[model samples]
Target: MGLLSQVLLLPFAPVRGSAWVIRQVMREAERIYYDPATIRAELASLEEQLESGEISEEEFDRREDELLERLEAAAGVQQGGGGFG
Candidate 1:
């Protein structure tokens, strides 16, 4: 952009910067959320909770299904098959 354009847009610089930061944070969050290792760790924790009687069998089954779906979605994304449809 020319100097005049930059000068005109300078007033919005803070807004632009804030938007960029938000995008970066969202990307990082998605990366962690879809990580296989993270998913596995969560699964282990869920199992522990069930074993300790912190959660009922029904609850465990529901949560396990959700985690399995996430794992499957992650795998699909890794294989370039796209995310949950």
Candidate 2:
């Protein structure tokens, strides 16, 4: 940016910095959320819960579907598609 523009926007620097930090955090969060290994671990945990009778079969099915969707979304992202949709 030009010196004049930088000076003019100096007052908003903190806000801009905060926004950038938030964006970084969101990107990291999404990375972790859609990670295949994480999803697989969760799926295993869900199975253990079912086996231990901690969750009903219906609950297991619902959660399994959700995890499978995450896996699909992760795969799509890896293939150059973006976002959950």
Candidate 3:
């Protein structure tokens, strides 16, 4: 079973408001809150800006890597066991 499925099977796992419970459980996944769409858009804009000489290539690459790292960190935080709370 998947991790989520296993978690749901726990004896005290709340079911009635399970969505809220899960959201609360994952809330500290990260402080950065850019949605996937927004992140993609921002990355595209950064790329275009760099190509157009509006921003330095170094700046573009740095910010892009930082955003990607944030995304990875958030994913890790979410996948982590109920250890954040």
Candidate 4:
């Protein structure tokens, strides 16, 4: 496109990226803090994929546990008032 259009799009790129990041964060917050079954189901599917040779067991377990731990920690932090200042 035009140079002006490209320049304008440059600043908006980060905003768009930030919005996508926020969406993901919100979904994670909901899964970890409100509805945990989403995490469990995703983990189960990951484990199944690993069992079927779609992914390595080490990677699968590592990612699954990491997600679980992150969610649990987020839940704990929420209970702790989220360190608001």
Candidate 5:
């Protein structure tokens, strides 16, 4: 590319930089969200809530299922090297 092209595109540099930062943030968020340790911590917390009656059995079961699915997916990713949903 010529210097003229770089000069012309300089106006959009901030926009492009912002977009890249957003993508990186999203990827990191996804990584943490699907992390096995994070999911296990949540499961433990959910159990604690149930024990303390902070959540009902029905609610615990519902949320437990959701968390278990996330764990299964994370395990699959670890084993088969897949991407997060």
Candidate 6:
């Protein structure tokens, strides 16, 4: 953009900057949410809760399935495939 174009766009600079920040935050959030280490730690904690009777067998089974699903998803994303061609 030329000087005049930049000057015209200056009025919208805050909106553009805010959008970029939001995108970056979402990317970081996704990275953390599917992190393997974080998932492993949570799985261990879940097991502890189950062994201590903090969670019933049914609930534990349900949560275990969810965690396993997340683990598989993270692996799939890392491998660039989800059992699909």
Q: For all the candidates, what are their Cα RMSDs to the real structure?
A: 2.5, 2.2, 10.6, 8.6, 1.6, 3.8
lDDT of each: 0.92, 0.93, 0.70, 0.75, 0.92, 0.87
Location of the lowest summed lDDT over 10 successive residues in candidate 4: 30-39
Candidate 5 residues 30-62, lDDT tens each? 899889999999999999999999999999999
Q: Candidate 1, residues 1-85: lDDT per residue as tens digits? A: 9999999999999999999999888888888998899999999999999999999999999999999998988998989965432
- Which candidate number would show the highest TM-score if scored against the true structure? 1
TM-score of each: 0.93, 0.91, 0.48, 0.47, 0.90, 0.86
> In model 6, which residue pairs have backbone atoms overlapping below 3 Å?
none
Rank all candidate structures by their TM-score, best first, as comma-separated numbers: 1, 2, 5, 6, 3, 4
Ranking by lDDT: 2, 5, 1, 6, 4, 3
Output the TM-score of candidate 1: 0.93
lDDT of 4 at 5: 92
User: Under the 3 Å rule for N, CA and C atoms, how many clashes does model 4 have?
Assistant: 0
> How far does residue 61 in candidate 6 sit from its true spot (Å)?
1.4
lDDT of 2: 0.93
Lowest lDDT 10-mer window, candidate 2?
Answer: 76-85
Per-residue error (Å), model 3, residue 80:
4.7
Q: Which stretches of candidate 3 lie over 4 Å from their true place?
A: 1-32, 78-85
Q: Give the TM-score of candidate 6.
A: 0.86
Per-residue CA lDDT of candidate 2, range 1-85, in tens?
Answer: 9999999999999999999999888988998999999999999999999999999999999999999999998998989967532
Candidate with better lDDT, 3 vs 6: 6
Best of the two (5, 6) by lDDT:
5
lDDT per residue (tens digit) for residues 1-85 in model 4: 8999988799799888999999888877665543356667777898889889999878987888876986686577668865311
After superposition of all CA atoms, the RMSD between model 5 and the true structure is 1.6
Stretch of 10 with least lDDT, candidate 1: 76-85
Error of 3 at 44 (Å): 0.8
C-alpha lDDT of candidate 4 relative to the true structure: 0.75
